[model samples]
Target: MQQTCVIGAALASCLAAGTALAQDDATLAAVEARGVLACGVNAGLAGFATVDSNGVWSGFEVEFCRALAAAILGDPALVDFHALPADGRYRELVSDDVDVIARGGAWSIGPDVRRGLDLAAVSYFDQTGFLLPVELGVSSPKELDGARICLVDDMATGPALDDYFHAAGIAWQPVAATGDSEARSLYLAGDCDAYARPAAELSAVRATFETPLAHVIVSDGSSRVPSGPVVREGDDSWANVVRWTFNALLAGEELGITSANVREMAATPSSNPEVNRLLGTEGEIGAMLGLPQDWAVDALAAGGNYGEIFERNIGENTPIGLARGLNALWAKGGLQYAAPFR
Candidate 1:
């Protein structure tokens, strides 16, 4: 797909200042003209983002990029995926190389305030964790005193691991690895006693290990982390489009809506007002976000709702196989909640 740079009236209202692009009307216009949504993501992360054998990008993060494209262009396939190395992703987004970032970048004050980026919904509730082989017989991270731990250097994971271990008064040696794969190899080869990374990510890696079941995750709650998408700050139009694109997915799940049922629900009248409005059977919700009246319908149809995406991507059926502990809908005792679409 060719790159178009059109930011229309809908986008103009949403773009905010101090964001990466800061509402360059021309840039947005250029995007629209190109007719494709440019997306940036990590080079490779098993459950997050990766290219498959057929050269198709697939993962939870990639689903989001497609969702946004479907919402904006009325066609989900209108997305141009740019797989970027970890070090190059932030720069790519800031320079307008991609419309948004769906890779698993953490939301922090530094990126929001300094990088001119705006973070959207927390799609995945994650936590940092340590993986030690069963042979180590370590019951907890606290037992890792004087142990050599391998982790990516200078990333958020290092500081988080340090702070948690420091507060516990645990002294350990840091064996800095250049990237996530390197860190895992160092630990797996006995170069280090443990490997540290996001719990879901670490679990995914361990699944590919020789004695996968022998790997143990530290049970501390402090490691839980949240991950989400990002766009240039100051573009309220772009931000809202991405933010509610996520919320709509959550709301669809809450309302028992799915891609299969949305079309039918849209045709028939129902007592539920929120459902009516969300499906564009009653309210102009899409107009508020500068999308077609059936935008939400299309977004949901592009993939399943948030819950569906969860189950398919990292949920029990997939290799990552994360249970919906904190990611469940608010009604079912999870943190996933959406603002009223009225």
Candidate 2:
């Protein structure tokens, strides 16, 4: 039989005639049975994931895990954070070391669907960028000709940087670093003229510098990457739960229901039916997902909505000081609107 592609807004990949896309819920069962959510996160990237001196895990990745736990187990603190290494995170996920691995590069064919893992959703829209001294007077990436650049080894940005500079006929000296922290250390020690990494991470790293005002980040559209949570394939049920957890965060933000106001909002069902349905006072949305009606309330309470999470952890007011450029809600002209709860 000849195969035909059925691509559309609904279907992302081509389905074969005899392919069986199973919806196993073993991961979900294990998570519930074990009474905790085991989530994989980066070992120690400032804005994304970090373990503080108090043995508390906190950051964007941390909040996602906690929210997932809140949805599944009814408590945000019922989480086991497994700090996975950069090169070994996928292997750990494949081995079932954690229920889900958060904070991957982007949604791509090989790393996601083709590799037997599903990208639940794009949690954050991040782009790779360059951090250089202000004195360099370089406002754009194309201006970095013959400059020593430090980049973390084995990142997608390598090929991207190569293509960007090669096409522009720009030459740059490459300084090797093992990871983001090393790149920051080397850049701070003046081992290289610039350090390259994701713009959010660059902002977080730069904020820790003694002379933060002396540095600047150069971002380009070509380096944009869609980063989010990754789960093993063949489990659409579990993936749906993960995706909706993110949606609830976004929905909370879009509906003006923040962590501070979520309890009040849930306690009193206002004129908005969607808000009532989301908070579990009106509809069976949680029951449909095999969760309690108050699941969203717990998730929202774990952290604030998406906007609150960004602002608290890495927004312009925070130490990381990243602006909500493309992360704002769709109603506000950003690309972060959620699908309907119904």
Quote model 2's TM-score.
0.88
lDDT of 2: 0.84
Off by over 4 Å in 1: 1-30
Q: Could you give candidate 2's per-residue lDDT for residues 251-304 as a string of tens digits?
A: 999899998989998989879888988999898999888788999999999998
Q: What TM-score would every model get versus the actual structure?
A: 0.88, 0.88
List clash counts for every candidate, in order.
30, 0
Tens-digit lDDT track of model 1 for 1-342? 233344886455444332444453433445568999898876677776788889898878888888888887888888899886643368888888888888545556667788888887788787777899887788777788888988876456777777888899988889988777787779878999888777777777777777788888875777657778888876767778888999898999999999888878878967999999988888888888778898888888998798888788778888777889888877788888988888
Model 2 CA deviation exceeding 4 Å by range: 1-23
What C-alpha lDDT do the candidate models reach, one value each? 0.79, 0.84
Query: Worst 10-residue stretch by lDDT in candidate 1?
Result: 16-25
